[model samples]
Target chain A: MDTRILLGAFIVYSLSTFFYLLNLTSERKNSYGRIAHFLLLSAFIIHIMSVVARYFIAGYTPITNSHEALSFFSLCIAGFFLYVKKIYKVEILGAVILPVVLVILIFATAMPSDIRPLPPVLNSYWLPIHTIFSFIGNAIFLVSFFISITYLIVEKGLKEKRFSFSIMRFPSLEVLDSINYRCMSYGFIFLTIGIITGSIWASNAWGAYWSWDPKETWSLITWIIYAVLIHNRMAIGWRGRKTAYMMILGFFSMLVMFFGVNFLLGGLHSYM
Target chain B: MSDIQLLAFGFNHTTAPVEVREKLYVSEEEIPSFLQELKDTCIRELVFLYTCNRMEVYICADDREKAMESLYRVFCNRFKIRPEYLSNYTYTLEDKEVFRHLFLVASGLDSMVIGEPQILGQVKDAYRIATTFNCTGFYLDKIFHKTFNVAKRIRTETKIGYNPVSISSMAVELSKKIFGDLKRKKILVIGAGEMCEIALRHFQKEGIADISVTNRTFANAKRLAEEIIGTPYPFEDIPLLLTEVDMVLSSTGASRPIIDKPLITTVMKKRKNKPLFLIDIAVPRDIEPDVNNIENVYLYDIDDLKDLSQKHLSDRMKEAEKAKKIIEEEVEKLSRAINQVDVAPLISHIVEKFEATRENELKKYIVKLKNVDDDTLKTIDILTRGIVNKLIHPYIAMIKENGNPAVLETMKKIFRFGEDDEEKLDNRKQGE
Candidate 1:
């Protein structure tokens, strides 16, 4: 039943993605954006239901396996994107973002989705708290990653004075930069808490608080890079193209920490 | 039907020099009187558009020869210009040519800068003024309204006015991209030259509240500062002032670079790396090129700005082709509508002529049949009317459905109504 609900969410997400792409390409004034926004809201509700159902069936947090982890991450991204859309006129960003979410959901569906028993080590309340915070932080940064790319394209075109209709549709440089800043600020707070809660969870699961595991070490590196970025942005006045470049760099490091640490180097957090 | 001839008379930037255009320009205050003078003559429907680049008058007249003569006389009397001299610089377009030219002007295709948006507003103002003076009737009103619609359609359907093409506007556009809002931003002007003043005025219009001016001569700086309501500083305080302002516009008559990389590096440190935008429009270069490499510093020199403007101009040129095609398509559609309107009166005249001929012949035959009863006479009248309508049904239908010019001419010839009838209709409308 949870799988059926997840499939319904995926279908709605696809429809929303189609509309967003249409909104981007269409020159005529239309309500495609409002329609897409409605669909995304509905998909978010159904997606939350699926996660709740999974939790009830599994008798623990649903982020234990690759399928559950990716699905939840994509859900967090959709949630954050909807939140950003409320504040900024960023309907155009959906044309790029919704497709990415759709692809991630596809990967999540392809993975083994069978409910499995929780391992002996991750059988605690810290599972949800630690994983949810970390996933939320990663989701916000993922959105900022795409925002950074858009910022670069727009900034380059304006700096070079080469204008195109396609580039003109993207949010302006200032709007994009502000969104990036807002994302990074919230993302940094969540990341810091996630790391602190992770260490506390480690103490509860294992004997020590600091294990220096491969995932732990990599998450530290990601945290330090973002720390430097935030510091530079607030203190050194790093903005526009420079901030965009830094955000992209931090996202790449985050990719290595999230994916590379799990598959390439087995770690304490590689139960999936 | 009214026999109002559509006429457009004007000279634009390409046809007349500035001196000639200025002499012919009618200010807004003078427009009502000028239009009143024309109304005193023979013109009943007219609109005058007077801009820096063009002087135009659109007319819907009953007598073209009389309207032209009156227009020439008014120009000669109002501006102290001779009639023969005015004719050399002016152009007169009638019918279809007038419609096409008006469409081009309203859509900004005939502008000095192709696809400019300001000319459309000016055209609207002209129409509004004409309406206030009660100078426009059915014909001019319909054409002007259609022109506005076509202009709007072209704006949405084409990218002709997408980017800023002028140098000052380009600088302003780049600053917006970097800084977002210029309302609270502070700017420092390096020189008091014409380029600096023009660009500064553009910036001032954007609401840059804190402006500082500096030049080699303190008096020149003070004079420029007083004119534009900015604070003037000595030239030696350039590095000191750079830290306080968000943007710097430098266009001096310097032989060497005035501001260099090292100076900006120190200034950025002092300002803690707040973003700085620099526009250097000097010929010999005001700021060094390497200053652009510093983080959070954007520098655009004269050549860079020119390249952008050149590219945008070319882009507009390409988009103008698309806009012109759209205009031509609309012109064709509207021309067809106008022709349909023209043939409405002709169609009614044909039907009326057939009915009149049928009644006259019926009367002549009825007088000869004195033995017929009243009921028989009524039946005969009905029979003759039905036979005439059925016989002429195909011809009337052909003329109404297919507004073909040759068909119209043939129908007129068959009825023995030729150019003389058209002249009579014109004369009758004049009487009305």
Candidate 2:
């Protein structure tokens, strides 16, 4: 039963990729898109079940160790995006979003084990708070990344005056710009909370609260870039392409924090 | 006989010179008369669209060739040109090609400069003209509605139409740069020429709706007012209008500079240091170029519209592409709908034909025979129509299910009308 549900989720994610690409290539995918949305939602449900099943086999929240943490991170991002999309109808985000979620889940499928016990360093209540907020921050930035990439793609099309036809489906520039701004704002707040919680956890566990770990440094850099953008947007009345460019750069800083700090440069937080 | 069609003919600055274009331009008074005059043009629908850059006669005809040729005659009569003179300047397209042209024009792709909003208003004017003339039919009106929709799509989907600063609009914006806002701005015009009219229209479009037109002659000022729909004051009121208006444009046909530096300086001090914008579009000199130095006044001739309008193409391309993609998609969808509308009736038509034939045969041979009238013949009538309906259900069903939308109607027509078979085939085909 467990493997069947997991397999169903994996299949659902894979199919979502195909439909997303199909929606791009063809214009009248009314049925195809509905099917894709349904499949992604089902995948999300099944993923939830699989996580519950895994936790039943072991114990605790499936977010402590490396394999479980990465799997949970991918699920959280997908779930959040799907939730926001339901409310906002920001349909253009689908082209960038679905494939990334599928890719992350597929990567999660390659991991070695189920959820395990947390280490002593992660035993504090502040640890889970730090990780949850960090995961939320990651999710928000990923959405920002989606919006920023759309901005670049849309900007290129507008340059060629490619705003006609269904060649590349998109929302208006104003809407995309606004969505990116909101994403950055939400992400910045969560990032601030996540960092503060991480600092508290570090102080309780290691006695040195603000040592410059790779993730901490990269996140600070990401925060600075976004802060600059927000300030420029608010103060100087910066708009359109300039604001879009800065958001894209901030996402790069986010990617460095998410994947680079963990895999390449092993940090103190990489025990699992 | 199949679906709706469209045809258009006109020349813009690209096709004709300024003299030819001005002669073709439709004044406000001219629109109603032109619409009334086009009643004789042998068209199912007619729209006389006249802007500064172009004048177009859009029409729908029962026959495409006949309509095109008749429109040619209408043009020659309207412009008073011989058949050979400038007849080659007009462009024509029909059906979907005509639809594509209309969409592109409405979306600002076919403007003298791309993304001009005036073309949209002109298109709407043409539509109004057509409706007023009672020349619009089902297809031409549908085409116009779709054209406007596509234009809106391009605007919202792309950045192509954003921040458009035409030469006239740049004059307005520059005026704003000198003055803070132009809500109650007083505007002075040296000449009552076409450029002045264009400038007035631009100012109105840019929200500087309050305007006072001053021309050299009282007669010309009145005539211009009647045409441009602006209040015209005498040339004596020029300095007074100057104090009231924040901007002034001079396109007069003067041989020498009219408003020199000293003349504008005196006017500016009277206005209490209020910023003024002056635009010189005359060849010789109407307002001296040295008036640009006048205190709290900014002046630009023709060259400045281009300088401020260097909006980065690279920044606009993404949105423009998105708009075009939307148009193409809509065109495709509309084309499909048009094709479906074309094909559906034919298949239904074939089905009806079969059923009618079965009824006719039954009524002739047995249904009308009262001598043999009983339950037997009544049963035969019901069975016959039933068999006919059953036989046709699959053939027409196949036509509806065909993948190539273009051929669906042709296939339906063939099944309905092309092949004739013996009457024996009906019942037998049904049983099979």
**lDDT (10s digit) by residue, model 2, range A94-134:** 66787887777767767766455666666667755888888
> What's the true lDDT of residue B431 in model 1?
38
Model 1: per-residue Cα lDDT at residue B9: 92
When only the first chain is scored, the TM-scores of the models are 0.98, 0.89
How does candidate 2 fare on TM-score?
0.48
Model 1 DockQ reads 0.44
- Put down candidate 1 lDDT per residue, B332-419, tens digits, no spaces: 7777777778777777777767776776677777779989898998899899889989988898888767655677778777865545
The CAPRI quality class of candidate 2 comes to incorrect
Pairs of residues clashing in candidate 1: none
B112-203 per-residue lDDT for model 2 (tens digits): 67777778987897788678768787767777899888887677656675554566765664454333346666676678898888878877
Worst 10 residues of 2 chain B by lDDT: B172-181
Model 2 alpha-carbon drift over 4 Å, by segment: A1-57, A79-98, A115-127, A141-271, B1-16, B24-26, B34-128, B136-432
